[model samples]
Target: MYKAACLVLALFAVALAVPSTYDTEHVWKAGNLSYVVPDNAVLGGFDPYGFNTYVGRVIYANSILPARVVVETGVAYFNTETLSSKLLVYDILVAERNVNYVWVRSFDGFYEKGAVAVGTTNKNERVFCCRAKTDGGVLIGTLLLSQKLCIIKHETLALRKFDKYEVLVAQAKGNGTLY
Candidate 1:
């Protein structure tokens, strides 16, 4: 019982403290994991460095400067078996630029190359999926997904969307891709 009490207290502390600020409502509901976003955030269109660093709930496009566009991401699943995650980054200049959203199979495995397995498309688009191997191991580095306009972007328990703002389109949507 003491261990259970400690665990509950730890969870409470994290809930009260993890959200350092109130840019957005720092929500985690119904299996959707999101970082908090500011209400009046301005998602600029720029990403010089390739990694996403969060300033509160929204990701910072650049460490020195704030995000050109306020963004959030989360993972989803059908149940307790199948699983996937996407990093839905967005921008204001382009509405949703550099959208590096992808879905993948949750597993306890290793892969040398990325899992950008989107093939059989005869469209004219450029995509580059690379990796960043630092001390943290390999990470999804480059992003290159079909630039299809998601005209009817909606927020669902299964889809990642911008918090506090009703967005129309996204940058990318992948089923699975490893950096």
Candidate 2:
């Protein structure tokens, strides 16, 4: 009886030591997962200004200041001629502080860390995600950072300010390269 009890305790300890998929630390580390923002929804699917259009690859719009573009790398901007033909793919980075929130990275390693603010430059603080549910009983992808959506500031993308904007929820697509 004593040996059995000891074995049981040992097994329990081992199980406790094993990391869970939802473990905060485990999510913080980058994994073999990638996602694409095929399109976005706004105002309960009353998408105007082509917010529901395809998001394309990252480009340095300004040649004079390359760093500026790098700083604003995470979100997609709209230029029908420039961004229409391509799609933007991002890698998932779970937030260290809150596993629920996530950060996205561009193919060139630019993170969508909110609206490129002046003071909130810390990477950890820029975690964003879509709300699980909304008033319309829809899984709307309102990509929020610090509870605010950043657009228009950099011509990244345009949507009504008060309305929630949706993002394609990132799922585990296996270790794949983001195009």
Top candidate on TM-score is: 2
lDDT by residue for model 2 (38-148), tens: 122112221223232121222222210001111123333222212211113222333222222222332221334332211111122322222222222322222324435
Ten-residue region with minimum lDDT total, candidate 1: 75-84
Q: Report every candidate's CA lDDT.
A: 0.25, 0.26
Off by over 4 Å in 2: 1-52, 56-123, 127-142, 150-159, 172-179
Worst 10 residues of 2 by lDDT: 62-71
lDDT (0-100) at residue 137 of candidate 1? 23
Model 2 lDDT, full chain set = 0.26
Best prediction by lDDT: 2
lDDT score of residue 157 within candidate 1: 29
